[model samples]
Target: MSDVRKPWLPPRWFIRLAWSVHRGLYRFSGGRVGLWRPKPGKWGAMRLTTSGRRTGQPRSVILGYLEDGPNLVTMAMNGWGDGEPAWWLNLLAHPDASVQLAGGSHPVRARAAVDTERDRLWQRWREIDKDLDAYAALRSSPTAVVVLEPRAGQG
Candidate 1:
């Protein structure tokens, strides 16, 4: 598994440090900064709060996301590494979760994209980041594309 070509993953220490800085910036800014894309047309970071699958505790992580009509789309790419992200795994066990955006928090239902939808959304991401597929290729397994749909009467 170590031989898996993960050209996108930075050094492990850098990953940890970057995550801390990103999370700190988001928390410190009250969802204003580090919460969305700085560029005009790109995915922004949001805090996805999920219930831990094993511990059943609230767990939150920052992730880049794209708006898709009524749904929010993200990926299970753990910084372009091999294994799936914890939030995605948690959602698999318990699909109910919450997302914190620049506006506010809302309850959402999580599901992985399928078939043609997956292809379409993947293409959408490609439009945003030309190197998306190249980063995805670094994984030994297929990176799951996750969609977060707002729950009725909840947002």
Candidate 2:
């Protein structure tokens, strides 16, 4: 939140570059090597395709997620940058989207987790990553915990 930078935090440019490389690798692999299912007490990667808020076109990204029963939870952390991620903004504009997992693809609707649910999910994340709070503090404000709920007819 402060202008003062933390010594341990990676620079914004490096973070953005790393994200680009990650996405590029996923795209280059044709999705075969990019995603996985979340195992107990751990996180996993998935491909989320959201409609572009402004253009109404598909935009996809690989994001880390934790399965919460029938729902998938991730953070709109923007690589822990100051602003919300574009995909999150897209979800806010158009809640309906699709996620590609190691098993298959399915429709999902996105929303921000709030109150006690958010606290619980955040605690879960802290269990997975001990530095969750430290990294989160690098942000100017609270990051929204995003929930991707399965749409009707899907388990």
Candidate 3:
């Protein structure tokens, strides 16, 4: 397989379009239609709502995730594009956030997986998606694997 990454990424317009549609479906179905993992994958999906780093307003995005015991693991890949996703950047400024699943929402704190844990999570992603490396190669920098830990003392 070639290491070239350009062809692997979806166009920016497509990304925006898909996101809009997903958000609409999620809202219209009352957390049923677009709440599961993305197509062709077996993981879970959650609406990660974060406070905008600059504006301090709420920002939400649907992401595919895997549950690691009590933590939710997700990759910060913007459709394999070169730029980092806004939600990940937001977490850097303010790690506290909330995740809404099909069942309910929970308070959570986001952090980057480090060292061996990062490696393990990245490998697990590849195991789930055989073309993960090719997609990662599309990015100019390494994609971050974010872990969302449930916050304490929240009902």
Candidate 4:
């Protein structure tokens, strides 16, 4: 994919710095706040834990996500430009993962949404933020819309 076509956002140094501060504050607050607080506008944090594909070690990343019905959907943002994100690749290798949202943590299974599903969700996502169109355009491989479904009886 051409670098010029990629949907690279502005340098996220400030956002990362703020996220670090927020993470620390949440830790200090006994994990009560900051989990659902909006950063600016509609963006917020989503903590996802997945097992390492090769090492079987646990890894966690705080990402931005959007809720879609009973599923939690997250764009493979980096993936659009540079193939699938490592964590997402890990999830593909091991579908069992966990997501932390406003209410609580729940075991989830991750998979790339089907074509029809992607078309529908992409429309909804674009409605939320038009910037995603650029992201969708940059995909070297098809951009994956990951669906995180709650484990049976866990919802």
Candidate 5:
């Protein structure tokens, strides 16, 4: 059997330190956060908004995303313990969400890839970060590969 405990969220001090670093970098880059890219060909930070599954309130998160063809795919990187991140759960319940890409902000529909599609998408994700293979091994539940498609009139 594998450990299934929830992954520890970053400590408050760590979060504060990271925020300070990000802010300083943003200022140095003339308000652009491009300096924080984890890997080449990957967008730095994306502002994604999804409706709360139960509360119906709007929630936004700054997440790393990769463009796959005309769609954008984001991994639920809550370590290998947490099955899926809360933002992903919200998007799953309400596919109508919004995202801010490199160019601009726009609404999009979210869908969790299934089966072979999921495998292919995961492979692309691995290409971006080889370390993700470790996380992939720890997951007993399906890791969601979320696809964000541009909404009509916003292509």
Candidate 6:
């Protein structure tokens, strides 16, 4: 008999360590390494800087994103960990933020996708990551799909 194999994730500490290492690379490189633009049919990495919900200080992190029309879509999964990512939490208290793309940086406003918007963006993510649902299943709550809309002067 054949059996289904569930998705596997590294230990929580390992996941956290990996994130720290990645952020370290970006910081140590002086903005020279890391971050990329999302290409057609693929997700890309970028640096998202948001204001701390409590401190009002700037907090930055690397994230994967997909381009949808003029907006950017990213997930609020903390490496599929139990709680929502702190960056997402910061966004909730302060939706205004900025993203640094491979090409350039821009001001943006963030919001959680809802209803049909969430459905469509989630599907697009699934297209890029065939294991999308599998990894998300590792978490306790639904991963939020975040939309980064350009400011008034931008697209």
- Deviating ranges (above 4 Å) for candidate 4: 1-8, 12-30, 37-44, 153-155
Model 3: per-residue Cα lDDT over 47-98, one tens digit each: 9999999999999999989887788899999888889899999999999999
What are the lDDT scores of the predictions, listed in order?
0.86, 0.89, 0.86, 0.74, 0.72, 0.89
| Predicted candidate 1 versus true structure: per-residue lDDT over 35-153, tens digit per residue | 76424577777899999999999999998899888799998988887898889999999999999887788899999999999999999898988777778887789989999999966
Q: Candidate 2, residues 1-155: lDDT per residue as tens digits?
A: 36434537677899878878888887888877778888877899999999999999999988999999999999999978788899999999999999999899999999999999999999999899877887888789899999999997542
Q: On a 0 to 1 TM-score scale, where does candidate 2 land against the true structure?
A: 0.90
Candidate 5 per-residue lDDT, tens place, 1-155, comes to 24533344566578647755765665577546633333564545676889999999998666677777778878776545546778888987888998765577778999988889889988877777665666566667767788898888541
Model 3 vs. true fold: TM: 0.89
Ten-residue segment with the worst summed lDDT in candidate 3?
A: 1-10
Show how many residue pairs clash in every candidate, following the order shown.
0, 0, 0, 0, 0, 0
Off by over 4 Å in 1: 1-9, 37-40, 153-155
lDDT of 6: 0.89
User: lDDT of model 2 at residue 129?
Assistant: 81
What TM-score does model 1 achieve against the real structure? 0.88
lDDT of 6 by residue, 1-155 (tens): 02324578899899889888988998899878888887777889989999999999999999999998899999999988789999999999999999998888989999999999999999999898878888888778999999999996631
lDDT score of residue 2 within candidate 4: 45
Q: Sort the predicted structures by TM-score, highest score first.
A: 6, 2, 3, 1, 4, 5
Query: In TM-score terms, which candidate is top?
Result: 6
lDDT of 4 by residue, 6-86 (tens): 455545576557767877776787768667733323655678889999999988777767677688887776634556777
Q: How many clashing pairs in candidate 2?
A: 0
Give candidate 6's error at residue 84 in angstroms: 0.7
Q: List pairs with backbone clashes in candidate 6.
A: none
> Candidate 5, after superposition: displacement of residue 27 in Å?
12
Clashing residue pairs, backbone N/CA/C < 3 A, model 1: none
